[model samples]
Target: MGKLVDGIWQQAGYDTDNNEGRFVRWDSSFRDSVETDPDARYPAEPGRYRLYVSLACPWAHRTLIVRALKGLEEAIPVSIVDPYMGEQGWSFSDGRDCIPDPLFGARHLHELYVRAKPDYSGRVTVPVLWDRRHGSIVNNESADLLRMLNRAFDAYANRDLHDLYPAERREQIDAVNARVYDQVNNGVYKAGFASTQAAYDEAVGELFCALDWLETHLKGRDWLVGEQLSEADIRLFTTLIRFDAVYHGHFKCNLRRIKDYARLEAYLERLYAIPQIGSTVNFRHIKQHYYSSHRQINPSGIVPAGPILPFL
Candidate 1:
């Protein structure tokens, strides 16, 4: 949980004390795009982009699911970072199932950020879409990457599936996503990482409120916005999947588990049944990362072995 300062990696803890004991996530720095238009600087092309991700990260996991769903596995390659992000941040491990950066063979993930921008100063996050041809980061924001992967490479995608963000449902999907992102997705972090009781209380209250609303809303519906699954479902699914396993205990967001919500539990099970979606989840990495990485939250670094997810 460190950052890069002027191309140099710094092993430092988060400074929540300054923000009135509230966890404020830093905005993603890279925001470039890979449009499908021929005039675009980053035109859609197979084998032109690479994804750097961490299985433990929900944001990064979004891209992985999108890539698989869109059949971009052969089009765009991926390199996964180690789950336990220590003082130096995400690192590459020399083990099976982990792909090394063939482009630079860098040990640390920050090295790629520095390679992209030597003066870069920010949190080195995952789901970085690197432009192999330009040797620079195309985008580090997960939402942006998800959209890009959805349609940018349609010409080369294995199948043609539109409407992940359909024009007619855009308004509803956007609205649902905004609230879910604030009160649920990011809300869990706010509650878990809150340094003050006031902050934690406010965050946890909001989180459960959103959950209650969702439980009622999804009682008979299959998806969040439209009649079909969209980006909103994908966005919410990542957080809900991890709620009971890690966030409930590690983050102190234990008001009620996702399993406690009948509707949400069924919803989660339905989404988890999706072939590509279920494969993206790595419980071992997810549990190990949170319990072991945040030393301040869990000083003992003792990983728990209970609350087994029945769906998984």
Candidate 2:
């Protein structure tokens, strides 16, 4: 993976050496929001915003789940990038499941970032909320986009049936999100991208510990918070769905598979059974991206064929 320096694409990978082999994720640069008020800078207008995403990215996957769950497919269109991230980073291709950028017809994702801010300097990551009206990026942070998409388009959403982030359960959901984000959602990356044995062991230990805690917490519950699915569940779902299929083997996070945790496995199946939720998962893209993109971990650049998901 690479980043843009002063709007110039640079082939630079993570600097785990300086941080004692820890895989530290860079902060998302764009943090604007889409509000419901018409006068707002980024009002939630149907057809005014476009989402740039990668089906392979878990962060980008979260936004896709929320968009589907809220039934905003037509309201907010999406353009998916090629799964196999080469040296040029995420790009548009005639490859299966790829969608070219309709507005600028840009070849690479960073081109759009350059269009948004000529001298923008950071890792050009997804899911990017592009404001078609302003011809600029609204936001690139998935956490922000999750909440933004959750309610911003309620007026236009086909299934504004339920609030994923309800007022009453916000506290609980945020708390759950914090732990899961640290030890679970991003824990797998910490373990996988770690350069040192100590870093990997520490990350793996926390990951399994968090998984064990989740198993206990979900003993007689259907969701992570409240009685219904919340942002907490959605955030964790993206990571859990990829655990056995990718993380276990590719990332060397093989302490135990999600299938081994009876409750988590069942919980995963239950969530995956939801049509909107299940459709967001693309195992082929997920596998190919991790195995091929992170060439440092898997120098052979070969995607695995086994460890079939039972839920599928």
Candidate 3:
């Protein structure tokens, strides 16, 4: 929740009040690439890059889903941070399904950020693409990493895997992604982390509006765009999965649950049923992180045990 100021870790955690009651996410600092082109600074190569992620994070979860779906587990290895992010921020403490940093043996995620850029000033985020040889981050933006994983490793991925973002349907996919990103994906955060009632109401209104549209659009369709599962679906899937678990209660986005929309709930189950999709989900980590990390929302730090997921 905390961020580094000129490579120095600051304990001043998530500042929602600074945005005038709006929860605006900080822009990702590292935006390099690992393309397939041979002349690229970070060429797509097996074993050259590793991912540092938190399973609790939806952004990071999307990248993991792409990795698993593409069957690139052998190509790119991952190191997971401890789910419970505290004042020190994301750490490498041993926990269920957590993989500690063996590359630099760093205790904190910010240490790795400082290691890459000595004077980096931004929130040290998860789903970090680390270049082993360059000894720096290739990219930290989850959306960027999602596209990178979708196609950059085609030569190394499983033969049975299909392209999530087909060239012909990219326009449609991007269009769908734009609306979903604003009103659905990041919208819940706006509602949950809002400091003012107006902000909360506005965000929640847009969120449910977007959900209503999706419920109507997906009436006779199998995916978000085109005839196949595209990147649009992956982007929204991460957010939808966490809606009831945390957003509904903790984030104050309780107007209507995902379960309230029959299509969305069924669509969620259909996506979850996909091979390797369920493996990417760690409900314990997901639930614990939100209910515990955001002290501003749930000060008591008491996590609920019910409102159970039907699919699980």
Candidate 4:
């Protein structure tokens, strides 16, 4: 809900008014790549990278999924912030399931952004790929980080970890990604943060339309892209896994629950059954962060406990 302007932490810095009640997400400013070149900035190393993520955030969740699928947990460490994001934004507290910032010992996530670039100006969002060697962020964009984690560090990753983004199927994967990103991935936010009835209607319509397409598309297919698992499935899985839990209620995206879609429900279960994939899901953090952090939406900050998880 806020951003950094010229390295200063400005609370509630985002303004969606210009879009005529549409909630437009700001672009992530920290964009660098981690390559496996022998002579490149932020070269791939076993312990040279770390991630700052919130289990609640779907964008951040993307990286976590890849890290697990590729077996990069031991190679690249991660620090989780508190779920209850108040005026101070994401902070590293000694709360349950929250891993404190051990690298910089910063109290908040913003400190790491500033540490990377003193005059940084943008939203402080995660799954930040921090380069311990450069003392800066290699990349903050979740989509980019997914690819990086899939291949860039394959040397350090487990030998059996299959490539989620294979070179041959990239075109198809990118196509699925484009549709999912605009419609379902970010459409939930657009609907939840809409300021007017028209904007809300537009967003909710788009969200459901996308879901409808996915429901049909996944009828006979187990994965989003080709015969095997790909980046597209990882991208859509984060949103689907959180749909009924948070998006359906908190975000007012209640046109239909993921359970209502026969194939989608089965597909969700299949993905969750993957080894280590379930560990990335923290409903407590997901529910609290959405219901509490967005005070404008849920003023009382009361997190719902019902609609039992069917993730397994």
**CA RMSD per model (angstroms):** 1.0, 0.7, 1.1, 1.1
Where does candidate 4 stray beyond 4 Å? none
Predict model 1's lDDT versus the native. 0.90
lDDT for model 4 comes to 0.88
**Clash number for each model:** 0, 0, 0, 0
| Per-residue lDDT over 59-157 for candidate 4, one digit per residue giving the tens place of the 0 to 100 score | 999999989888888999999999988676788999999999999799988899999999998888888888887788888899889888989888888
Predicted candidate 2 versus true structure: per-residue lDDT over 159-260, tens digit per residue: 856888999999999999999999998999999989999999999999999999999999899999979888999999999999998999988999899999
TM-score of each: 0.98, 0.99, 0.98, 0.97
Candidate 2 backbone collisions, by pair:
none
Candidate 3 colliding pairs: none
Each prediction's Cα lDDT score? 0.90, 0.93, 0.90, 0.88
lDDT of 3 by residue, 100-130 (tens): 9989899999999999999998898998999
Q: Give candidate 1's TM-score.
A: 0.98
| Runs in model 2 lying further than 4 Å from the true structure | none
